[model samples]
Target: MNKVAIITGGGSGIGQATALRLAEEKVNIVVVDVNEKGGNETVELVKKLGVDSIFVKADVSKQEEVKNYVKKAVEKFKKVDYFFNNAGISGSGKFYLDTSLEEIDQIVGINLMGALYGARYVAECMLKSGGGSIVNTASSAGVIGQDSVVTYSATKHGIIGLTKSLVAEYAKDGLRVNAIAPGPTETPMVREFYAANPEMKENATGGIPQKRLGTPEEVAELVTFLLTSKAQYINGEVVRIDGGFTNTK
Candidate 1:
């Protein structure tokens, strides 16, 4: 039987790249995102790779939608071998004091609450099937700290806690939960963030020892390995893929 994965935010960026990468291994995919066009595009790409895939348009912030996506994945694929709980927003690049309450709610709703809802339901299903793996998208800000992105940082930090705690509770039950903290990866979301905060981009690249933003494909490689049985011994770890960006600080 082929493995199956459900990638939230699979419409673009790291999620999209990971979907394609896993599809290359013949894993059936369930692409979940709010953007129908991008989600369909990912499905098409996966299909061209000769793997069965489907798109589930959902607002991960809402628990019902999160549950529906898990239900749909189970209905279509019978089991979820892996889950990329990667849907999130970067919030307006405003100073913490200047950031609005609305922005904080929006970031927390989607980035933090959405991840928890997805993991809650997906873990239940995985527990039923004996075992599964999950990778949550954390950020460089999640590990250390940055000037801006307070709300975004909080959510990503919450993600790291979620990853570790889930494994702490469920490792014996055959669940492996891990997180990836990437440093300014080149993704559509990151591009939009940089476009809004251009100066920060130069600062970020300059700060990284590699002097360049990481690529979605590079992050996808790490995610794929963690999601597969090859990483069976790995659990509850937050692996940093930030080209020495966090090392200096």
Candidate 2:
């Protein structure tokens, strides 16, 4: 049978790229995102690749919404062979003290809590059906410290913790969990962030050893490998696709 994969934040950027990559492998896809337009667009694109696809609109931060998406995926696909727990947002670049409380809550709610909720429900379904693989989206800031994105960095750090801990508890049960740390990827979200904070963009590009941002397609490749049997032995690991950006730090 063809495999089924669920990708949260599947509307754009790394999520969309990963959806297309997996579709190329003939895997049926379930695209979940709050943006209905992008999610539906992805579903249509995946269908064009000659595989089944569906779109689930959801705000990952809400537990009920997360559950609904998982339910929808199971209802349509029967089993979730893979999950890309990749929904997140980069806050308005600001120093922690200068950042508003509302912003902090929103960041934590979506980035950290959303990821937690996804793993919770998806893993349960995967365990019941058999073994499955999951790849969480972490950031370069997650593995290391950075300025002006303290909240975003913290949530990413939590993601790493979630990845490792899940493996420790469930690897024996046939679930593999891992995280990817991308450095300043040129995704829509990153572009919007840099547009609002242009100086930070220049700084990010200059700091990276490659002197450039990473691409979503490149990150998607990593995620696909990790989520598939090609990386069956890899779990509880944080793979950094930062072009030596984190290495220099």
Candidate 3:
């Protein structure tokens, strides 16, 4: 039987790349995103790779929307073998004092709360099916501290907490939950952020041991390995794919 995966934020960047990678593995995908165009584009791209794919437009921060996505995935694929709880938004790249309260709420809503909702609903569906693997998106800011992204950093740290706590409560029940902390990845989201803060981009690249930004395809590869049976023994782990970016700090 073909495995199924639900990737939140599947419309673009790491999420989209992971969807394509998993499709290559013959996994049916549920691409969930608020951007209808990008979400549908992912569905069509995966279908061309010969795997069944569907798009579920959702705002992952909303509990009901998150629930609906999980329910829809079960209706179509019957089981969720993997989940990439990767929906998030980087804030406006301002210091905490300069950041607006509304911005803080927005960032927390999508990044931290959305991830929480996803893990809640998706894990339930997976446990019902015996067990499954989940990979949540964390960040370099999550593992350590970085200036200019206090709210984004806080939410990512919360993601790590979510990943570990879920495993503690449910690993024995057959749920494998893990998180990835990527540094300076060249995703559309990151690109847009860096475009506005060009100086920060240069500083980021210089600090990385690799001296360059990471790619979504590379992050996708890590997520794929972690989500598949190859990583069955791995759980409650926060794997850093930051190319020594956090190491320097």
How high a TM-score does candidate 3 get? 0.99
- Give me candidate 2's TM-score against the actual structure: 0.99
Ranking of all candidate structures by their lDDT, best first:
2, 1, 3
- Give the TM-scores of the predictions, in the order they appear: 0.99, 0.99, 0.99
Candidate 3 on 83-158: residue-level lDDT in tens?
9999999989999999999999999999999999999888888898798999999999999989999999999999
When summed lDDT is taken over every stretch of 10 residues in candidate 2, the lowest stretch is 204-213
| lDDT measured at residue 54 in model 1 versus the true structure, 0 to 100 | 94
What do the candidate models score in CA lDDT, each in turn? Answer: 0.96, 0.96, 0.95
How far residue 206's Cα lies from its native spot in candidate 3, in Å, is 0.6
Candidate 1 worst ten-residue window by lDDT:
138-147
Q: Per-residue CA lDDT of candidate 2, range 90-123, in tens?
A: 9999999999999999999999999999999999
* Candidate 2, residue 57: lDDT: 93
Poorly placed runs, candidate 1 (over 4 Å): none
Candidate 1 per-residue C-alpha lDDT over 1-249 given as tens digits, one digit per residue, 9 for 90 to 100: 899999999999999999999999999999999999999999999999999999999999999999999999999999999999999999889999999999999999999999999999999999998989999999889999888999999999999999999988999999999999999999999999999999999999999999999999999999999999989999999999999999999
